[model samples]
Structure formats: structure tokens, C-alpha cells
Target: MDKKLKRKVLTASLVGSSIEWFDFFLYGTVAGLVLDELYFPSSDPIVALMLAYLSFSLTFFIRPLGGIIFSHIGDRIGRKKTLVITLSLMGGGTVLIGLLPTYAQIGVAAPILLIILRLIQGLGLGGEWGGSLLLAVEYAPKGKKGLFGSIPQMGVPIGLVLGTFTLTMMSLLPHEAFMTWGWRIPFILSALLVVFGLWIRAGINETRNLKKRKNPGRLPNYRLLIH
Candidate 1:
């Protein structure tokens, strides 16, 4: 790949990875503070907090499954397509959580839906990390593969910082307002980031490796285990 195109791919990979992690970590930041009260309320504040954190933790288990499933799809279909789907899933779940009605508004169904969205977000993230890293590394020019691979890793800290900074800013609102709606702003705003990431990723062609594969055959879980 040309230097210009490699740069574009690297940028796209980094941006998309950052956005995904930002959305993923946003929930963790909000869970103890806002989700407990709004989505997982209980008479005992501790109980509510635990429930919220439980939702946060449960997603971790689903992530590995997501990684396996999406990796297979990436191998068979294409990394670009897989990355787009994962981003959509993560962004879609985040936006929905922002728009979701609270337990006060929807009763038991609210927390259930919130958990479902969290799982979706987890799944997207599970797939997102590898694909983003691969997208950067695969497009990298000789002698710079390590450097290009490191670029996507930057997204982890970048996303964490961005998520924390956004919430800190939003929290400055009056407590009632912050609790009522301010918390959702970051989640909703993720849509714009997703759109921008998607636009950037859409411009890049499929990596040469996938294109060169004449027959990308299926590799089931059992086969993977055997290997």
C-alpha cells in the first residue's frame, strides 16, 4: 500500500477503535453513578449498585463469544465488513441506552433492556479490538508493521480518557438534570463518532490478504480447538 493510503487506514483504525472503547467504557463510568438509580434501582442503594455493576461485569463473558463469532466472519467475509458491523452494533447499543426509558418509566423491563444493550456493546467491542488492530497492521508498509500495530493500541487509553472527561463535564450540570438526562449525552453523541468512523472506514478498500484468498473456507469452533 502507498504511504497515503496506509496513513488513512491507520487513522481509520485508530478512530474506530477509540470510539468503540469509548462507548464500552461509558457504561462502566455511568453504572455506579447513574445506572443504579435509573435502570437497576432497589430499596437498598448497595443492592442497586451491585446490580448495575453486575450488568457491567456480565458483558465480559459475552465478549469472548463475540470475538469468536466475529473473527470467523472476518476470516470468511472480510475485515472491513466485519469492522463496520461491529461498530454499528456498539454505536447502536450505546445510542439506544441513551434513549432508553428508566425503570421508573418502564418498570422491570427497563433494566432487562439495558442489560441486553450492554451485552450487544460487549460483543461489538470483543470483535472491534482485533479487527482494528489487524486493519492497521495489515496495511502497514514493511519495516513499520510494529509501529502501525501500536497505533490502534493507543485507542484504549484514549477512549478511557475521553469517556472519563465527557462524563466529568456532563456531571457539572445540576444534580437533578445530570441524573435525569445529562448522563445520556455521551452515549447519544457516540452516534456522530460512529458515523464519522464509518465514513472513514468505508473509503478504504479490503486488505490485500483477504482479496488474494481465492477460497476463504469455513473453520468451525471444533476445527479451531483441534488446531
Candidate 2:
């Protein structure tokens, strides 16, 4: 690949990976601190926090299923399209979470919706990491594939730092305002990052590996089990 195209591929991989992780981690950061109070309220604070963390934990269980499903699609279709689908699922769920009514407004439905969105986030992320890594590595120059592959992995820490910093700053608002709307800012603003990532990924060509394969076969179910 040409230098310019390679640069675009790596940038898309890193940016998309970072945005997905940022959205995923944002929920965890808020689960104990904010979601417990607003969406999983209970008479006992401990129960409420546990419920919130439960919602957070639900994602991990669902992620493997997501990985299998999307990985099959990635093998059958192409990485670019799968990346777009995963990002949309992840980012759309996040933006909607920001807009959801609290338990105070919707009662049990609030937590239920939160859990569903968390599942969607899990699925998106499960597919995202593999696709992003492939995008970077497949397009990398021959001798530098390892270096390019590592670029997408960097998104994890980058996303964690950004999520923590943004939430910390938002936490500075008065308790009332922060609970009321401040917490939503980062989630809502994530839409912009998603849009930007989509644009970048859209401009890149399909990976040479996928292009070379004229007839990509189905990903066997046993392979999923092995992985």
C-alpha cells in the first residue's frame, strides 16, 4: 500500500477503536458513580450499586457472542463494512443511553433499557477490536506490520484515559446539574466521534486480503468454539 493509504487505514483503525472503547468504558465509569443512583435505584445503596455494576458486567458475557457473529460476517463480507456496522451499533446505543429517561421517570423500564444498550455495546466492541486490528495490519508495509498492528491496541488506554478525564471534568458540575444532564454530554458528544470515524473508514479501500479472496467461505461454528 502507498504511504498515504496506509496512513489513512491506521488512522481509521485507531480512531474507530478508541471511540468504541471510550463508549464502552464510559458506562463502567458511570455504573457505580451515577447509574446506580439514577437508573438502578434501590432503598439500599449497596443493592443499587450492585445492580448498576450488574448492568456493566452484562456486557462481558455478551461480548463473545458478538465476536463470533460479527467475525463470521467479517470473514464473509469485508472488514470495512463490518467495522461500520459495529461502530454504528456501539455509538448508536451510547447516544440513546444519553437520551434515556431515568428510573425516576420510567421506573423499571429504565434499567431494562440500560441493560439492553449495554448488550449492544458489548456486541459492537467484540467485533470492533478484531476488525480494527486487521485494518491496520493488513494494509501495513511488509516489514512494519507488527508496528501497525499495535496501533489499534493503543486505543484501549487512550479510550480509558479520555473517558476518565471527560467524566472527571463533568463531575465538577453541581450535583443536581451533573445528575440532571452533565453526565449525558460525553455520551451525546460521542456521536460526533462516531461520525468522524465512519467518514475515515469509508474513505479507505477494502483490505488486500479480503480483495484477494474471490470466494470467502463460511466461518465454521467449531472455529468459534476453539477461539
Question: lDDT per residue, candidate 2, 1-227, as tens digits?
Answer: 48899889989999999999999899889887889999987899999999999999987998888888887898788889999999999999999999999999999999899898999999999889877877787787767878988999989999999899999999999999998999999999999999999999999988777777777777722232112
For every model in order, what is the number of clashing pairs? Answer: 0, 0
Question: Where in model 2 is the C-alpha error above 4 Å?
Answer: 220-227
Error of 1 at 123 (Å): 0.9
What candidate 1 gets wrong by more than 4 Å, as runs, is 220-227
RMSD of each: 2.9, 2.8
Candidate 2 TM-score over all chains jointly: 0.94
Cand. 2 Cα-lDDT: 0.88
